[model samples]
Target: MTAYEAPALVISECQQGLLDPPPGAFSGLAAQAAGRGLIERTAELARAFRSRSLPVVHCTIVHRADQKGMLPNSYLGKMAIEERMMVEGTRDVQIPAELGPEPTDLVSSRATGLTAFYGTDLDAMLRLQRVRTLVVAGISTNVALPGLALEAVNRGYDVVLAEDCTAGTTAEDHRYMVDNLLAMLTRITPAADVIGRLPG
Candidate 1:
């Protein structure tokens, strides 16, 4: 895919809680991310964006300590509240050190909802920066990244999914979403190609 002007790289839900979960907590996803080298690839993309003076936004999922405003309507939502997963200020919610905000990058954290744009200032930040395209990479291709892509599209931003830099609960699940679902919403791309196409 050709590089689009004013593109921002949005890395969603790449927090420790999701990608490097505790024992017995989302082990499948953790394994998948590690096996696919998701962190390394995402880091590469982040660096590429930074080098080009492009925006790098980290979309993190986090909840308050009291769980206020965090709905328990869905199973995952309920689990997050009950298990205290992704609590703000906790290590679980922090992005991995391998990939960072780096003092220059922006971070948009959401207390509720699945997609980044829903409850955060992500769109406003993008608009302020005049970002026209969004390059997404991160965990759970089964859910969050796909949701982010759809939302970005609806918001009139072009989207490109860095397939190699994302991971789902399993390889099969990841492939299915990328092939059947995500492909319909955005251009599916590899990290290397995206990096190469970026302005130096």
Candidate 2:
């Protein structure tokens, strides 16, 4: 089999609230994403994957209006609840306009948790598509992307992280996580490299 056999693009937390947060709400993360051109790179990757008919899974985090089933166990969680971010029907939970889900793409949304797989059918959706390798991208390499890489691996999927298509709270934080944590869990590659390797 080829290196990227049955590969799928799994974009995590590319939502407006997370990647393009309002003023005073994760502004640092928004700045980092903009500085690195994270959305544009991920959009390029998404286009390439779509061209190959590969599954493009958007793993989003959203909570209900009442915040039921959502736990404030961590600082981010508590902040999300307190800030009223990522509520289901809000624009904050929606993916940015740059990257389209298109007609064929899959969106797997979860009400709680950091990783996409914890309370969602992301794995099942991928499995249904016969996906073997996961090309991951999106926000905050410090948390979501790394968590996604680990969860994808534990669930028996090979992971390839598009380094340029993701960011963190800060440039230094992003670099450190990619070098120390994510590097240990996934094959860290640039978006162009991933696109070039896509099977026609």
**lDDT of the candidates, in the order given:** 0.89, 0.89
Off by over 4 Å in 2: 1-3
Summarize candidate 1's per-residue lDDT along 124-160 as a digit string, tens digits.
9999999998999987898898889889889999998
Report RMSD for candidate 1: 1.1
User: Model 2, range 1-200, lDDT digits (tens) per residue?
Assistant: 24588899999889888776788898999999888898888999999999888999899988989999877899989998898899989999988888877889999999888888988889889999999999999887888888889988998998999999998999899999999999999998899889878888
Flag regions of model 1 displaced more than 4 Å: none
Could you give me the TM-score of model 1 versus the true structure? 0.97
